[model samples]
Structure formats: C-alpha cells, structure tokens
Target: MVTDIIAQAFVDFIRRVCECENLWKAHAKDLELAKVGDEVTKAISEGVEGEYGPVTVKVRKKLLGRREVRVWLYGNEIDVDALLAEISKARSRAAWLLNDCSENALLETLYKYEDRYLIEVAQRNLDKVKNICAGELPRIEFGEAPAHVVEGVVKGVRIYLSGHGTSA
Candidate 1:
C-alpha cells in the first residue's frame, strides 16, 4: 500500500508538472504580446527623447503613407521612418529576451514550481515529495523488491529506472 502511494505520488507529480507547463504555454502568447508592446513603447520613447530632448510620444498604427506606424510627439508628427526603425529594434530586443532564457535556469524555475504543486496536491511534506519524485531517490525499492520503472526529470535530465538500476 505504501508503495502504491509512492507510485501514485510520482504519477501525480509528473501530471502536475505537465499541466503547469501546458498552462504556461497557453498564456505565453499573451505574455509575448505584452512584452513586444512594452519594448516598442520604450524604444520609441528613447528614440524620441534622443532626437527631441525628452518629450512624451504617442504611437498609432494607421494605414499611413509608406510606414507601418505613426508617431505623434506631443501633438506633432515625427519622422515615420525613424519611428519604424525604433519599432523594429524593439521587436528584436523582445524576441532575444524571450528566447535567451538558459535551459538550466528555466528548468530550475520549473522544478521549484513542480515541487510546490506536488506538495499541495499530494498533501505531503515538502521533503517527502523531493525524495520520492524530485529525483532525490538514488534507487527506489518497494517492499524488498524494486519496481520495473520509475521515470522523471531531475536537474534537467530525464531519469528512467531499468532492471539493473536507474539511468539518465
């Protein structure tokens, strides 16, 4: 029964991790949109500041003549070409920030959330969850016999239990 409970814990941990990740992915697009907008705004503001000495700028996307967006610096039209370049630079910056997250760093963050979620769902002590599913278990043996398989992600590596032992 204890073994069953532990096995269930492992299953539940994996499910929650996947669920959390799916939820994150579903919202990722919205976050990206927000990031792009913020970056564009900052880039335009900085460009305008550099050229016009720190004046407030408002941006509008209209079917303007030969430009992607129109900028109004305190109720006056600014150079459309310059504004377009600023938009391009901002988009590239946002893309780089979104894509440059180190895999290890992202996995570390995921692990922390996975642990928290598992603990909440299992109603188990934090340490116990870490031992069972967080890959702290060197080798899992149940009631004097080892299980056929135990699989999980540990420190950004996938671990699988084999007949001989565990392997990455």
Candidate 2:
C-alpha cells in the first residue's frame, strides 16, 4: 500500500528527529559541545554571512567549578546563551516533530497525498529530511553529526559533574 511506503519514510524521518531531539536535550546546557563536538573540527559551515564563521578550535575535558565541563573560548566564537536557547527550542521542536509527524501523521498525509498525488506528500516530508541532513533545521548548527555526539559528551560529563551539584 502507498500508505506503507509513506509510513516507512515517515517513521525513519521521525525516528531521526527523535534521536536528534534526545541529543539536544542531553546537551541542553553544554552549548559549546552542542555547537561543535569534543574534538577539533573546522569547516566552511555558514547558512548566511556573519555567522559562526570558519575557524579551528579544539575542545576537551576541562575541570570547571567542582567538576569537568566542556567550554570553548579560543580559536572560534559562539554565544553560549544563544546556543543554549537554541538547544531548548530544538529539544521542544524535536518532541513536537516526532509526535506530530509520527506514523499517524504520515497516514493522514498519505490520504492527502493520495487525494493529490503521492509524490507531493513524499516531497514535503523529504524536504524536511533534506533540510535536516543539510543542517538547515531551525536552530541547529549541524544535523549530520552522529546521534551519539551529545549523548557521549553528557555521559562523559556526568561522570564528573553529576554529584558536584547540590540540589535537594
């Protein structure tokens, strides 16, 4: 059935979005790592001019406060607050996308696709994937980054940062 085809694509896309969302949520505080990664990488990534720009910087585990955290202050420039805000919005959007664009969403779209032509719906959803793949999503710097980037960083930080905070 056409719905099945569309459903498969939808599930794949939404699952990716879910993984991306979880990654952002895990690094909701570490903007530096969220923007880049734990290692050094440089590329000509710019959706527009006057943005983060091209530069090279290395990131690694550094002791901060009573624990180790990843922070970048040399080689490249980024707004920590801004990055955190983006992470917040990204997290919310990911959850929304997964829920809103789930199998049911695709099924519903399939009806419209059928009414109009299957290609139409497929293109729209595919556009989302393309944008995501190209890192053109709303508030993310890079979407192609592996899903484990943030997850790994968080686990690494939690190894040292978890108990340092006193909340009760």
Best by lDDT: 1
lDDT per residue (tens digit) for residues 1-168 in model 2: 433444444434434544555555554534433344312222212111122322232233346723222223344355544444544564565556556655455445445423333334333444344344333332222234333432332232233223334111
Query: Among these predicted structures, which one has the highest TM-score?
Result: 1
* TM-score of each model, paired residue for residue: 0.31, 0.25
- Residue pairs of candidate 2 with colliding backbone atoms: none
lDDT of each: 0.40, 0.38
Clashes of 2: 0
Cα RMSD for predicted model 1: 12.6
- Writing each residue's lDDT as its tens digit, candidate 1 over 1-168 gives 533443444554544444444544654544444444544466564443322322234444447532244454334676756644544564565455455432332334334433433333333233333343334343322222233212222312232222114443
Each model's total of backbone clashes: 0, 0
